[model samples]
Target: MKTIRSRSDRWFDAVNNVLIAAVGLICLLPFLHVLAKSLSNQASVMGNKITFYPIGMHVEAFRFVFAHTRFFEALQVTLLVTVIGTVLSLTITILAAYPLSKPEFKGRKPILLLYVFSMLFYGGIIPGYILMKALGLLDTIWAMIVPLLVVPFNLFVCKTFFEGIPESIEESAKIDGATNFRILWSIVLPLSLPVIATLGIFYAVGYWNNYFHPLIYISSVDLKPLQLFLYETIANTEELLQEQPDSVRLSMAPEGFRAATVISSIVPILLVYPFLQRYFVTGMTLGSVKG
Candidate 1:
């Protein structure tokens, strides 16, 4: 037999469910409206004709966007940045974080204080630009890859997590005749998967969405990352349309095509997100729990 709730309890539960659904709709409606607008006729959109649903359907915005040569070139650059940047950042961050995680290692305290100090400040853009220029990294992909070799937040989290791990494991490995480098490589790396995966996703997303770096450092049109290309595509649509009178000008930029580009850029990350999502909570919690 089912037990009935009191009138007040039922009312509260009903209100709570309503609130949850309302919040979900608030989040969901915008994406749907964007999708609808992407498919809607330009005339309908320009006059503010559509509301929660599109007034009329159209698909030309995507066609127009894909027809350009620059989109593909920018896409290739973005892929390179996301893949290579993620790997390089992971390598540097993990290598730096691992040593800092261990306290018994000599000079770890000073090195950590140095990392903490770095988090607070940076040489302004002019000096940074001069250094990069002196190094001949300007307009080169290396400018994007080399500048962000260390991440302070990742280092701290990793350090805290490593501190939580007992020193006895390394001691055991050493007692078994394993060298310092060997124990770190063979045991610590394997045990550190959760944090590594977590940081990998974080760095990957940062690289994928990075635009300012491309704007400041890269001079060649070919070197523009996907976000920069997408920004230019959205921001300069009118000028582009002006240059080619007969070519189509998408009024709403076909919410579909814009959404499609966004979705595409994110899909790679999404594919990897599930695997790491499990580790994310645990990895992130390590710092909080240890502290």
Candidate 2:
């Protein structure tokens, strides 16, 4: 059977499409402009002539950034924290989420309420700093990973998704003499790939872009993450440029450096997202559906 749309329906569809396209351009144009600025020559960048495309193509900014020792060190730090933090966060979230998803678990409500409560409130920065100091975690890489190990909202999302899985699968595994660990390892994880990939992206992005925690806890120049390094570099560019010998400063494009730094920091997540986008969409749909 085929149904035909009325003129009014067609009009509404046209309007919706226009609005969605406008919204997408709004989100996309800024990145394009930044990319243009990053790649454009210093003269055009400083003149603000580059918009969505490079006016005079150049790669000097990228070369300068790649050659900088501080940038390389900070990039390494960000990668380490992102990889290690995402793995730890996923493992801990899964362990906690699986147990909480079980209806027969005693104190589940209380435990869940505790998680919800944490989500609603936080000890302010002073207390968090004090606690980090007490634990001797400040100024170290663990300082980046430990404080944000498990996000409560993500935990609940995973738990809710886990609960949506049919109990019969677990029962069948049990009947086959599979231990709970075995069932979770072999049966549950394979089926939960969508959610796991989604959560991994979430955790990776969070850790990758985190600057506030690093700003507060890290003091060593060598220990700062890429985001923090970028922040400091941008903020102190004038002072640093003034200190540089005239020949070096004359060649460096501050605006191009800034744009390149922004691109470098964001490009990793942009690269990773497209690959996981299908799983991300599927996971969100399944996780949102009430079982």
> Each candidate: what lDDT?
0.74, 0.87
RMSD of 2: 1.9
Candidate 1 residue-wise lDDT, 165-205, digit = tens: 77888889999999878987898888877777777777877
If scored against the real structure, what TM-score would every candidate get? 0.83, 0.92
Enumerate clash totals for all models, in the order shown: 2, 0
Clashing pairs in 1: 38-255, 39-58
lDDT of 2 by residue, 135-170 (tens): 999999999999889999788888988999999999
Instruction: List candidate 2 stretches off by more than 4 Å.
Output: none
Best by lDDT: 2
